[model samples]
Target: MSISVHLDRITDPIVAQDERHAGSSVRQPELRVLMATRYGRLGASSRLRLLQYAEPLAEQGILSTARPFLSDNYVKALYEGRSRLPAVLAAYARAPALRAAVQEHDIVWIEKELLPFLPALFERALLGANKKFILDFDDAWFLRYGGEGEAGGRNRLVRTLLGGKFPTLLRRAALTIVANETLRDWALRAGAANVLLLPTVVDLDHYPPTAMPTNPVFTIGWIGTPVTAPYLARLAEPLRQLSAEAPLELLVIGAPDFTLPGVTCRHLPWSEATEAAMISQCDVGIMPLPDDAWARGKSGYKLIQYMAAGRPTIGSPVGANTTIVEDGVTGFLAGPAATWADRLRRLRDDPPRRQAMGSAARLRVAADYALQATAPRLAAAIRSIAAR
Candidate 1:
């Protein structure tokens, strides 16, 4: 679409004439945005929250320049179980340059905290209060700053120094974009002037609902990075039990070496190109998370991806998973007493139920969580913040 046509959809002729009369042109200058994401495309949080919207926002006259704190090498090293001390030091060294870069753009979109381990006061001094920046959070990273049950002296020091940092940033931000209601409520409690609940979404074009592939073995699939791979351990016993009763295999993507003691496992490296098709191969998708502040902050993008692929999901009824899965309708939510094995067995026995739920899950994603559904709102929000 042409820029003029885009402008016409958003701005009426009367408004243009009014602007012209007020000594301003009908055509506004393209809004330049500085996207300070924590990591490059390798990082899922930054990829889903900020980078994915860049092209769509650009088409709407909002151009963004993404500056990642950590490089792709940092992500690669982290995933490969290598020490990231050098990468951390390098990222900290490079962070200060962003303070000066803030003045070059109309609006700054910060993915999370500007500086890790630093107080908000220091960040304020570096960036200043004059520049308008949008603060975004897809996870409750603040929980790391001495949350509940931390008794160590080092934890106390961290809490004292950085506990209030997120609140300060939230209070001062021109707009705060969060991935789920848990984070949104946090921002509101922090006195954020504006809060937008923009869930992490998938591109429907990339994740088209296809007919479920026929497989001799029923596959229970999961995709996540190493940082989140530990959560899969929650399902180990359940999966092991299910493996005996059903012709099942655990298909693990992203975490290639993940395994279970009694269950058969197939691991595959995650690539953007294959993730959608990879998900479609599974009979069911699962996201198991502990019920904690940190887990509650998760955006449930994994569920969204599975739903978009026309696959039924079983997620822990914690955090955004509660909203993403429609319990008995679209997918099942494993509660505290709810056995994961029971849910898996039920879906395994009833292929028609799985197909019905998968179809409903796909429709749910298309309506609320797809990139096509949310991109316009994101672009408009960015434009609104820039205009202020």
Candidate 2:
């Protein structure tokens, strides 16, 4: 309940001292990192963005221990539309654990904060405890406290208390890693002293293209969580029009209820193992996002995954999507409903062009967006911050 109580519950003074001494010890070559992950590996921010650094950084002798605020059970329950009170309490209980883990490490890498919704001042015990804090953000969480995540009702009260603290967290952090340039600018405006842009990337070895589909039916695919499900709805009119003019099918992974009239909509649950195969199944992958501040902060992870799978992507011409899609090369950045239909028609009708784009997409990923390409940069950033 109280700060003292939490510290008393999990604080390990001996371990803390050992960590402090380890920092001065010249014998140790590896850097110990205590990662305050927002969720387990299932969460993209934690998995693709942060956790992927573990193996590569380890090779460079940076060992990391992840202490997740939310558990797998909490994520499963929340996605199922269940009450989040139990999960909230469970996550709250882990705050002290994370604080304790932060003690024996050279650096603390947090996805966001020690806990969301709590007052930003509460961060000092977990972060400001004389540690090199690497605060990583993959989304525009500042909007949540202002409006986005709040659904009115009693949650508004939570939003009010949690409001306006993202800036404070950025300012307090030793280093901030943001997913896009938009968020990096926000962090700079928030007074963050050090910031780095680390967009979401994929391991090509793990997500190489599958055998091209032999079916005559053209398939347009989308993969994301339920919250982004509505983004696909924005394409309904254009997709419906495209289907009427041609034989097109839709596969919605992670959103079971997503439907497009005149198109046969199929759904599949999101699974790490099957996600690559699912992306490969598409003749074209689509990422539709509204052009807004929140959308601008997106890292265009879906587009990268699609490109890595060697499926040409059709993305909204917004934020990082613009840079990743490489319009007319790896994919097209469709602006309006007509543009969406036009690009869909082009990719659908031109097999040679589509195959060329897919090949180029794979090459683009291998060149820039692959985990190997980015991991070294991240490790270098961490090393630079640590030395400072």
Candidate 3:
């Protein structure tokens, strides 16, 4: 069943005119943006955000080109080669291609992960005209070197090499883009200037609400990658208990290894289209996150996706989840396994209420979070930086 809801037409002649005026007034600088990302794929959250800005920046005559530090081919080969020293060195040697690509762009945007090879890439990019560098980081990567709760200190080797590198890297950046106010504040405290708070956004056109299933099963769906797979495993027993009294199905997408007892588990392979289809089929989307430093830096893209698909999302009140979801209005925030069970049971019983909340969630995303609406703000920021 496909629900055909027309999104408000976002093409404003005035907006186009404003973009034209902005471009015409400012000398069309040969502003090329170099995005140095860990994963070079177009599908990742960071790459998507870069595309959102790039498309609009192009409209305003900014030439934005992304040079991903790591390519899928390299990663595939490295993993398939399995920890052989030669294979690892071959991967490390590919950093020069990224440095060469950096020469083509005027502004170098570094999505620096805590990887050893990145500093060399950073140093190489810094060689050319000391190009206007923009540092982008989401999570608390500095704290991630040591295992959580084992707080003596980070590994001596890692600490010696990377402990102080992030601060040094930030000191060199002309501008910075952070995921939220929390990150922005941290950057400021750390003495970084020109910090911009740009939260992760969705391609609303692609993620529109589909027709709702009429005889839909009361399915609690969770969609995430392999890294977050264990969180879904943690949900198994609570879902099992929930299924006892209620007609419940746990739809797990993207986690190929996830399995739950007594619950109808539908495990689908990970694909962009497949993930969207699976999400659209959900009655309620659940994002159960561990309340940790790493999870706090998450921009709540999963919740945004669920809400944009017109599915009421129940997520943990961590990081940007608190900002994205308005409890009982857009979706409920579950504190524990018991809360997760209660929220799932409540939504399962009340289909009409679920539909209403889903409708509200869609409206909320359209108003504030849609890429079409928010793209111009980002474009304006780029223009402002370029003008300087």
The best candidate by lDDT is 1
Query: Which pairs of residues have clashing backbones in candidate 3?
Result: 2-211, 3-211
lDDT of 1 by residue, 1-388 (tens): 1111121132323323433443334454688998989899989888888999889878667889999988888899999999988998999888778877888888889988777778889878877868898898998876767533232225668889887788888878887888888877777777887777788999899987699768879999999987788899888888878887878998899998777799898988899889999999899999999887778889998999999999999999999999899999998999653378889889998989999999999999998898877877666666566655
Over 4 Å off in model 3, which ranges?
1-30, 73-88, 113-129, 145-153
Whole-model lDDT values for every prediction: 0.82, 0.79, 0.68
**Per-residue lDDT over 193-232 for candidate 3, one digit per residue giving the tens place of the 0 to 100 score:** 5666666777788786786556546778788765576777
Q: Is 1 or 2 the stronger prediction by TM-score? A: 1
TM-score, per-candidate, Cα-based: 0.90, 0.89, 0.85
RMSD of candidates 1 onward, in order: 5.8, 8.1, 6.9
Q: Is candidate 1 or candidate 2 better by lDDT?
A: 1
Candidate 1 clashing pairs, residues 3+ apart or interchain: none
- The digit string of per-residue lDDT tens for model 2 on 1-388 reads 1101011121223323333444363543679998788889877788877787889889767899877788888777767778878988988876676656877888989887777778887887566557788888888877867734332223667667776677777766777888877777777877787776767889888986576677798999899887678888888898888878877789899988777666789899999888999888889999998888788889999999888998899999999898788888999999899999999999999988889999999999998788877776666566666765
After superposing candidate 1, which stretches have Cα over 4 Å from the reference?
A: 1-28, 147-154, 336-338
Q: Rank all candidate structures by their TM-score, best first, as comma-separated numbers.
A: 1, 2, 3
- Compared with the true structure, the alpha-carbon lDDT of candidate 1 equals 0.82
- Model 2 residue 239 CA deviation in Å: 1.4
